[model samples]
Target: MFTRIRMVVLATNAEGSPDLFLTTVDATGTQYEHGRHYDMALPRARDEGYETPMIAFDQYDAAARMLRRAATFIEGGDAATGN
Candidate 1:
């Protein structure tokens, strides 16, 4: 029993150099590094139901950025922090 998974990495380039590396794990337990993209197959359960095999790098980046911004707001003189 095996499953297919995809990993998408997003990073910023500085002076032709790569900066910041983030890794994400899909349902198949495959790890992907930032600025690098790859796919692999994972072990799956025989009794598992239908599963969609896909990964959206843009979406993940957007969500991560949003969360970071939110955290900054909360930590930086924001009412939510109750500071």
Candidate 2:
């Protein structure tokens, strides 16, 4: 399954698209911005692949959604773990 490493929701554009930045699960702390002219960060799983990439929604729910989804990929050793 695809796992996210570092993902950040920057801002929601005037056109209503949410601005997102993220890096592959194999890598961490390195964030990439996602926009129309750029390719979104690819999701990756150690020793696995083919999982659907993360989807971005409106700004109203982006933060909550990201946090929930991101929690799934976090491991005990992950630096961002709020322990």
Candidate 3:
């Protein structure tokens, strides 16, 4: 069966800081796997002379784990799925 895969990019900026970008690719297929990339620089922000934003990989990994857990719940998994 063909499952739907979706890519989501999240960007954030502090009040006085540059914008940070993150991208996640999620697969809604049988096994449910995901891939993510973080710390991507925003060209516009750079072009306008804004400092390049930074994202800690540890933080991104934690967030990605949380998102995966949420996805498991959204899929209606039980204790058997370790969700």
Best by TM-score: 3
The deviation in Å at residue 68 for candidate 3 is 1.1
* Alpha-carbon runs more than 4 Å astray in model 1: 1-60, 77-83
**Strongest candidate by lDDT:** 3
Mind giving the per-residue lDDT tens digits that candidate 2 earns over 1-83?
A: 33344433344334455544433332222332333211343322211232333353322345655565566547544435444
Model 2 regions lying over 4 Å from their true place: 1-5, 8-38, 43-50, 56-61, 64-83
State in Å the error of residue 31, model 1: 11
What's the CA error at residue 71 for candidate 2, in Å? 6.1
Per-residue CA lDDT of model 3 for 1-83, tens digit only, reads 44433322233454555343433333334434323222222343344444433332323455556667767777887523645
Model 3: number of backbone collisions: 0
Residue 51 of model 1 has an lDDT of 27
